[model samples]
Target: MEMSSIVLRMSPTLITNVRIFDGLSVVSDCGYILIEFGNIQQISKFPLPTAPGWNIVDGSNSTLIPGLIDAHVHVYQDLKFIETAIQYGVTTVLDMHNESEWFKKMKLVADEKNDVADIQSAGLAATVKNGWPSAILRMTAAADATLETRISGWPDITDNETADQYVATNKAAGASFIKLMQEDGCALSLPFPTRPIPTPPLEVQKAVVDAAHRNNMLAVAHALTNDSVLQMLHAGVDGITHSSVEPINESVISAFKDTNAFIIPTFAVHASSSGEDRHTRQRLAADLADTREKENFLGCLHIMQAGYSIQNSYEQITILKEAGVDILCGTDSSEHLVGTRAGASVLHELWLYVNRCGFTPIEALASATSKIAERFKMKDRGIIEAGRKADLVLVKGNPTESIDSLNDIIGVWRNGERVVWE
Candidate 1:
């Protein structure tokens, strides 16, 4: 198992013995991918040496996918998270939070994916002052109980830490795109507001979108609520994150569907087992009873079914599989879900979509690869076939039939470099 210690020069790398799901169809034992430089040179029947000095590796009974792309993850968190992502065969992780200097650093470390998958980012969320990032947007000490008082007393504000300026600066600093969050009535309860929260003022959202669009960039928004999503659509934002769990009015959902805008349900973050937040401090932590998880699950299911497309939330996105609503894979919590299994979360998400939401596995995988390629205009790598990028994963079994097989990952290769698992 000794690979050359000398950093092999990037030439062509051959990955063989895979059960390849080549984007369009799956091939058994005929999985071979070849990569040269940063492109996926070709995918064929057992790629072999046409020239000398090329690197080579044989996969050990692993599931080969297109090196899963977790479209929304916190890339700045820790290198260990990247290590875990690689182990699970994720070749790319998109960071949605934005900042200029941070973007430069993230790019430097992630540019070619030296230690992990290729990393790209959307700068900090463009949100109303005191919105979206209640805690992370700026330093704050307001308790949840005191949240209402703080919102009322606080002026409509944006912070230097996460202002529109920070978002714009990241683009210059090399952000892949810009991300925005819409604050509507639903997010506020009690005196905060009665209905779903309204979106960030249109003019403010426009400023961010216009700036990004003018630069030929894409803008994704945190719009799960009906009104919030409609506002983004009206602003001409390109994409959405989150699927509404509650209902929204019908007319708004129709507008979104007609526009054909993309919605990325960052379901993984929302599905996080209540285990993620130890910070609740024993005082605030809601202890779980035996039936609590089930009750919560049922509650979420009810929300999933709410509104036009579940009240414009499309909460149970799978129900719309027949509607041809293009969905994409994005685990907004990848950094926090760190482990050999975090990469497996996307696969788990696919399962949730199927067992819970009713999408076919093929549809789910498409959400991760092909659909993303189409949405981002990154057509080269999402699929497998001749003349496609060889960024790949070699799994132990066939993913075409059972996505669970993807969880049995044995190796990953990006631009043909056999990503030796750490």
Candidate 2:
């Protein structure tokens, strides 16, 4: 499809009378923002007179904040998923997994003028033989499903050399970062893992992290239990994709503070496992008007039957926060995955931080905005500053006062182009 022609005619927009949250904190008074040529030209406390070429918008004292970023997602081939994300004001997604070829194609679209959320992907994550995802696939796929087709394309690393190769291949394929799977599947708290699940040895995981560092890329590990989290911590990974499923103790707190690694936590998926699917679905339906998203939520509800301990995960985050461990927001959403619907679930995550995990509103907002960009090294677009890309959202009320107000999205703009969901 062609890029929207209407955005071409609507440059030099001047949005005035808006409460600006520049990704860190909320501004006390109303302000004005100027957009020109797909970038923020100015942000001012006092309104400036509009020029002839400017399309002025009176925001009527509504909230304007940087468009949200989902720190973790597994985007399959569906491009509409990105569009749905933008409709909910999630402007960028850090994709944790997908095939390299498909990721490259999606990245191209992210660069185009289409009304979709931008993507920075891992391309293909490093896994080992008979590991976490292999077990997940076996459980999800039909009995007649061919194993080779499912696992052949995945990069399976056995030694340091193979681990290095895996990182190199992903970097060459335009990966934004390196993702290493360290989960043993039992951490998922499902009953099917009758025996101990396989995972890469710590040395191999360390080699991959070293290779990624040599490439000047961030290495994020997928860990769900204390053992896996410690293994990845010992490997010196830059970040953890999920928090420890076990209780947070002094040892774990000391390890996190000592390493100074950030965490994504992805509590939405944990909430699904912990039997909060009904509450999640009701919240999504109450806040969003999109029927497609509602239907997707129904599909996700079916995937949440497996029991997992969300209380432990929530406590882990609380302990980590008290220990001053940096946290970033991510939903781990995908069309194929259960428990998370893209775009909308990130807000739910912030809600969890505030209502359950003991985070202030601004801190929760920072996890999805500035902190994500800083952690991922996305230098350009996280804040609503002059010279940043004009990826922004306008909501009806102040989100700083009540995060649920984010659901009242009045408008969205990507690269200075006003996004119309239809």
Per TM-score, the best of the predicted structures is 2
Q: Cα deviation of 182 in candidate 2 (Å)?
A: 0.7
Candidate 1: stretches off by over 4 Å? 1-11, 27-29, 46-63, 135-168, 188-199, 273-315, 337-342, 385-389
lDDT at 73, model 2: 87
lDDT value for candidate 1?
0.59
Give the range of the ten consecutive residues with the poorest summed lDDT in model 1. 276-285
Model 1 TM-score relative to the real fold: 0.75
Taking the candidates one at a time, how many backbone clashes does each contain?
30, 0
Cα RMSDs, all models: 7.6, 2.7
Question: How do all models score by TM-score?
Answer: 0.75, 0.93
Backbone clashes, candidate 1 = 30
Q: For candidate 2, which ten residues in a row score worst on lDDT?
A: 299-308
lDDT of 2 at 108: 80
Q: lDDT tens string, model 1, 239-344?
A: 7776654554456556657868777776555543212212211211123232433232222211121122322223446544456666778766544332113454
In the range 1-422, model 2's lDDT, one tens digit per residue, is 33445445665999999999999887635999999778899999998878886778878858999999999987767797898889889999999988887887887887775489999998888987777677776777557555667578788888999988898888998898999998766655445554566778888888999999999999998988787788898899989998766777777788889999999988777666665645755776675576766665644333332434667888999889888989999978886466677787887788898888889888898899999888888889899899998999998888888888887899999989888855
